[model samples]
Every structure is written in C-alpha cells, then in structure tokens.
Target: MDGPPATPPAPKAPTLGNALHRFANPGRFMRLSGALLPWLAAAGLALSVTGLAWGLVFAPRDWQQGDTVRIMFIHVPAAWMAMGGYVGLAVASFIGLVWRHPLADIAAREIAPVGAVFTAICLITGSLWGKPMWGTWWVWDARLTSVLVLFFLYVGHIALSNAFDDPERAARPAAILALIGAVNLPIIKFSVDWWNTLHQPASVTRLGAPGIHVDILQPLLVTGLGFLFVFAALALLRTRTGILERRARALMAARAAEPAATPSAVAV
Candidate 1:
C-alpha cells in the first residue's frame, strides 16, 4: 500500500519581535555596532560644536532674557535628552520583560546610568538658568518635581540592577520598575499645561508651530540632534563593553568551577 505524503509545516511569519531576535547574538551585535560607532561619535561632536558656537556667538539675544538666552543651547537639549532617554529605557525594559532577550537585558542595565546623567544635567542646568531668571535656584513646580522623580527612578533602576550578585535574579524586577515609572513621563511633558508652574509652556514642541524665532530655533534643533546622537553612541559603547565583561566573567567562573569537578589521585 502507498502511504500519503506528509504536509510541510508553514513558515513562521515575519514580525518586529522576530526581527529583534537577530540582535540576541552578541557577536553579531558587536560586529555591527563597532562599524557604526565612529560615524555616530563624529557626527555628534561636529553637530554639538557647530550648534553651541552658533547659539552662543551668532544667535540674536532675547530682548527679554538678554545674554542668559544663550543657556538655552545647553539646558533645553539636556531636558529633551533626559525624557527621551527614559523612554528608550522603558522600551528596552519592555523588550527584556516580554522576550527575555539577553541583549535587551544588558541594554536596560547600561542605559540607566547614562539616563541618570542626562537627568542630572537637566536639573543642574535648569537650576543655573533659573537662578538668574526666576530669582531662585529651586522650585516645587510640577515640571521640576516630575523631572526630579524621573532622576530618582533612574537611580532606583541602577540600584536594583546591581543589587544582587546574580543579575538574572534582578532583571525582571528592575524591568517592572522601569515600566511603572514610565507613568511619570506624561506628567513631566504636560506639567506646564496641567498646572500653573514656574516653568514656561512648550516652545519648541507645540501642537501649533514653534513659538521661537528661526535664529534661535535652528541652533536648538542642531544641538538637540547632536545630544541624541551622542547618547546613542554612548549607550551602544557601554553595551559592547558589557558583552565583553560578561564573556570574561563566564570564562573566569568556568575555570573556578573546573578544579572542584576533578577527582584527586591517590598515591600507592
């Protein structure tokens, strides 16, 4: 009797999750990022220098703010980076939680400290910019409070990620914390409209066209893009270093365990 031919199984459908899975291999990620890093670093440096120089030397001074307006090049871009970096962290955390992707886990770990630095830069620069304009260095304003909370969230994530000797045990909880803290992002962005705060309303990112003049706007945009590129380059660099560190740790642990598994010889 002739047997019926078996049907071949259907191929898996393409998807974002499936696409991201390719980055799970550390070797592949390392090779690709190594090639990409130099370009990002150079672009970031050139753009940042051009923007700061244009803003500081060429941009017309605000009739109201006078020379203090120059600080916008640094302060505004920093605030943007702080919030943007946190969003990236939350996304990486989601990828880590949902897929248990090792690279995502490593990325989440590396991003926290860099995000924290951006948050701190925003706070410090905000204070300095405020001291001259607002007449005080500190305020309990809604936007400021929300941003401070964000800084704490970054600190908490860093603390949690390194709390245990075994990182796998800590990964899920830290990821969950990042997701929870993302609730504050909307609060930070909308704080001006949500409440009467000391901080000004949206200037660059308004639903309507931007309120600022082109002279100020151009430099601001360049600096903002520059900060984003630098942040990406830094995060990728840290992730590559992390992958190498993990490899070293694994080799050392394996060697440490090797001797205990061997039997000792007895002399006759």
Candidate 2:
C-alpha cells in the first residue's frame, strides 16, 4: 500500500483514443494493424484486378495513343503518388518536429523510399512514352526538370536522414529539407505556364472539364484509386515494421543491460 495507491493505473490507456494516438502503445499498434491489414490487402487486390480488367479489355483504345494509352493508367497514378508522397513526407516531418510525434517521424522515414520508387517509375515511364510520342527519350522541359529536382530531393532526404548517428538529430534536418523540397511540387505543376516547355499543358484539370473522354477516363480514374489504396496499404505495413524493429532493438538493449539469471528449475 503506497501513499498515493499507484494513481489508478493511468485509466486503462484509452483504446479508441490510443487508436488515433497509435504510437502510444506498440501492442495496440500491432493489434490495430493486424485487424486493418487484411481489409486493406483485400481492397487493394480487388481494385487493381477490376481496374486492370476495365483498362485493358473494356476501355477503348485512344485514337491517337492506341495501345500506348494503357500505359497512362499506371504512369499518371505513379506521377500523382510520387508528388503526393513527398507532400505527405513534408507534412509528417513537420508534425514530428513541432509536436514530437514519434509516429509521424516513422511515417516520414518509411514513406520516402516508396515515394522515390514512384518518382523513378514516373520518370522512366514518361521517358518511354515520350520516346514514341515526342520523338525523344528525354527533354530539357520544365515539367521534366522539376520532376528531376523531386527525384534528387528524395535522394538527398534519404542520404541526409541516415548521415547522423543520433536519430533525433537526423530527423530534424531531414524534416527541414523535406519542407524546402515541397515548394518544388507546385513549380512542377505550373511549370508549363510559367516557362515555355515541350511538356503538354493541363489535360486532366481544365476550366471546362477533363479533356479525355469518359471511356478512357473511367479506367484512368479506377486505376488511380487502385494505386492510391495500394500506396496506403504499403505505407501502413512499412511503418508498422519500422515500429516493431525499433521495439525489438530496445528490448535487446534492455536484455543486454540486465545481468543473466541462473536456471533454478530441474530440467531433463
């Protein structure tokens, strides 16, 4: 019987709130992810399958692009997510720095590689598409240049974040870097107008409406949603893995610190 009676065990740790505050308990994080992963996995599979079916089989070939139009479903979404992921990283990094949310840092760290992959895919595929359409493998246009900057930014974040010995110290500078790079995204979006570039003007977003027709648009939209879900699922899985790895390292360090106990029970 202590003086304060142990402070009521901290009110049972509030699962619903803990769900929102995921980094509060590693066990809760594991449980929530375990429950959610299956659904995300299922939905991702279903969407990709359905979207591929529509895009490849049912959707009409573009009169101009022909079979190459199929590539747009993948290319456009990869480009969108590449930019989207970087913005997410910057936001998460900012939250981690300002609020000191551990989960936010993990999210930022885990997402960068995925974003980099998407950015590379977007660039390569765009180049491939451009070769046939524009008669060149690469161009010095504004859109392409901005995307190249994005790629280098991702590389810089990855390299700089790991350069420091202390994780916290590394995280802060990396966060700042992410914020600085985020400004390039808007430049990437508006580059066609601000500067004369070989890259085409906005086709997807226009004052009147989308330039593309419904038949192609439906597949494009479907694939985009599929890609979005896939990104979410992958991000969650990677973040969870990072959390577990950190916990394991902590436990190992704790074990190393404590003295080894002698075996007392009889054994065969």
Candidate 3:
C-alpha cells in the first residue's frame, strides 16, 4: 500500500490557439460552420444593406467632388476589403506552408477569387471617380499601379493553385507566391506618401484625427466593416463548399476502387 497519496496534476488551461486548432478536423468544422453559417450570412447582409443605404442616401456630398464623392463609399470599402483579403490570403498561405494544413490551403485557394473581385471593383470605381475628378479614365500613378500588381498577384495565385492535379503539390507554389506577393501590400498602402500620385493621401487613417469629415467617415467606416464581414462570410462558405466537394470526390473514388462484389454464382 502507498504511504502518501499523490497529488493529481492540474488540467491544462484552454487557449485561443488551441481552441482554433479544433476546427482543423473537417467533420468538426462542418458541423460548427453549418450551425453558424446562417448567422454570418444574415449579419453580413443586414450590415451591408444598412451601410450602403446610409452612405448612398443619407451621407452628405463633398463640396469639392460634389455628388461624385458617393463613389468613395463603394470604392473605399472595396479597396479596403481587397487589401484586407490579400492579408488573409498571405496568412493562410503561411499556415499552409508551415503546417501543411489542408484547410489553410483550401482557404488560400478560395480567397484568391474573392480578393481578385474586390481588386477589380476597386480599379473600376477608382477609374470611374477619376474620370470626372482627374479628367481621365486611367493613370499610371504609384498607388494605382501597385493595386494593379496586387490584382496580377491574385490571378497568378489562382492559376498556380489549379495547375497541378495533386493539390498538395499545387499548394506549395501557390503559398510561396502569396507570401511573395504580400510585399506589394505595403507599397499599395504607402504609395501616395512615397510618391506623387493622382490618388489622395490617407483620409480615414492618419497620425492624428482622420482627414475625412465625420459625416462622410462614419458611413464609410460602417460600409467598410460591412464589406469585411461579407468577405469573411463568403470565404468561409467557399471553404466549406470546397471541403464538401473534396470529400465527395474521395468517396466516389474509393467506391470506384472497391473490388466488384462477386456476382452471386447463380445456382439455376
């Protein structure tokens, strides 16, 4: 018989990192995400509608740009989401490269298209706004050019991600490209201050108070947040769909590979 009772070790404390890793299990992720999907969708839609309506209908027009400033609501949000989305891509790529996580790789692949769309929207609206303000539809300014490069990076990642039949092989190169392309993000952010450009300098983000008027900035912030929420919801939905499709393919292939059931020797 033991003379002294031994003390039991304390259970490990829960951590944010550890909790997040639980989603690495595809079955666990599917169930949780399915339960949460409707809430995300509803919240994104509601915020987007409210923000867009407020920005378009209720916000005051700028004296300098007049009604043309309305484009900022749309253009600014898209621009922010484009960069924010790229940052997310780079993060996902980093995770994929280091951990070889299937979810991270799938997330990186799915994020590319959404980021590209936002980049395209940014360029289009910027051009539309520029035509009236700058008297041109296009300009090779530092900010604009950097954003263009960002767009190209997104496209290249998408192409590379799909180039290989083996997703694992494809993931490495795509992840590398995403990491490399992350260099362009800072350039896009600082291009206005770094060099002369038709594009305006920071209005909503600055050293002290935002340069933008509050009447305009409030709706802009709301719309930007809405855009961010929608982008997140969309990316998660795509990732979920990708996971389901992959599982379906694996099931089909496994069934095909099964030995044909021996036709019952038909005893006449």
| Strongest candidate by lDDT | 1
lDDT by residue (1-268, candidate 1, tens digit) is 8789888999999877888897567999999999999999999999999999999999999999998999999989988989999999999999999988878888988988989998999999899889999999999999999999999999999999999998877889999999999999999999999999999999999878899999999999999999999899999999898888889889999898785533444331
* Candidate 3 structure quality by residue, lDDT tens digits, 170-243: 98999999999999999999999999998999888899999989998888888888888889888889989878
TM-score (all chains, Cα) for each model: 0.94, 0.85, 0.90
Model 2 TM-score is 0.85
Model 2 lDDT tens row, 42-129: 7877887788788888888889888878778778888989999998999888887776767777778888888999899899989988
Better model by lDDT, 1 or 2?
A: 1
* Worst 10 contiguous positions by lDDT, candidate 2: 15-24
Candidate 1 stretches with Cα past 4 Å from truth are 260-268
Better of 1 and 3 by lDDT: 1
lDDT of 1 at 34: 95
lDDT score for candidate 3 against the true structure: 0.90
Number of the predicted model whose TM-score against the real structure is largest: 1
Clashing pairs in 3: none
